[model samples]
Target: ENEVVASMSANVFKVQVAVGDKVIAGQSLIVLEAMKMEIPIESPRDAEVAEILTQKGATVSTGDVLVRLK
Candidate 1:
């Protein structure tokens, strides 16, 4: 299993995938807003999304787990 984590402190702007969704490397899994800019958090490898740890509008700090995949 692999996890997608927040790279910086930010508010989750959007969630593009859900649990059980099939995903590929580089696909956007979540969007975060930091410093007034939108950042896309992407999948690291091909996998099925196993969990979403954050929701839209949630605040997250660096290294916080956002999504889990398997």
Candidate 2:
């Protein structure tokens, strides 16, 4: 199992994957907006998205789990 966590405080700009979606390593799973920049949160390995813990327009902090993968 793998977990994707936010790397910094930001607003969720978009969620690119849904639960049960298959993803590849380095695939963009979410987009975060902070400091006027768009930051892409990517998958670290090939896996199936098991859960999404956040949504677009939601605020998140560093280390917050955004998605769970298996």
Candidate 3:
């Protein structure tokens, strides 16, 4: 199976994609906030969202997995 995993170099602010949602390449999946600036995480492939590993306003690191696709 193919998957789209997302992570950031800062705190994650929100997850925009849900499970079972169809996503395209370069589509936004999560938003990360760092130093008061918002960063958006995008999908790498055209697939369906399989899991959400981060919550809204959750503190995350560079290696954190924000979303998974299948």
Q: Which one wins on TM-score?
A: 2
Q: State the lDDT of candidate 3 residue by residue for 4-70, as single tens digits.
A: 3444567778878889999998899998888899888888889999888888867877766778788
> Candidate 2 residues 1-70, lDDT tens each?
3999999999999999999999999999999999999999999999999999999999999999999999
Clashes of each: 0, 0, 0
Candidates in order, TM-scores: namely 0.97, 0.97, 0.85
Model 2 pairs in collision: none
lDDT of 3: 0.79
Cα shift from native, residue 52, model 2 (Å): 0.2
For model 1, residues 1-70, the per-residue Cα lDDT tens digits are: 4988999999999999989999999999999999999999999999999999999999999999999999
Q: Top lDDT: which candidate number?
A: 2
Ranking by TM-score: 2, 1, 3
Model 2 has how many clashing residue pairs?
A: 0
Q: What TM-score does prediction 3 earn?
A: 0.85
The C-alpha lDDT values of all candidates are 0.96, 0.97, 0.79
Error of 2 at 63 (Å): 0.2
Candidate 1, residue 2: lDDT: 91
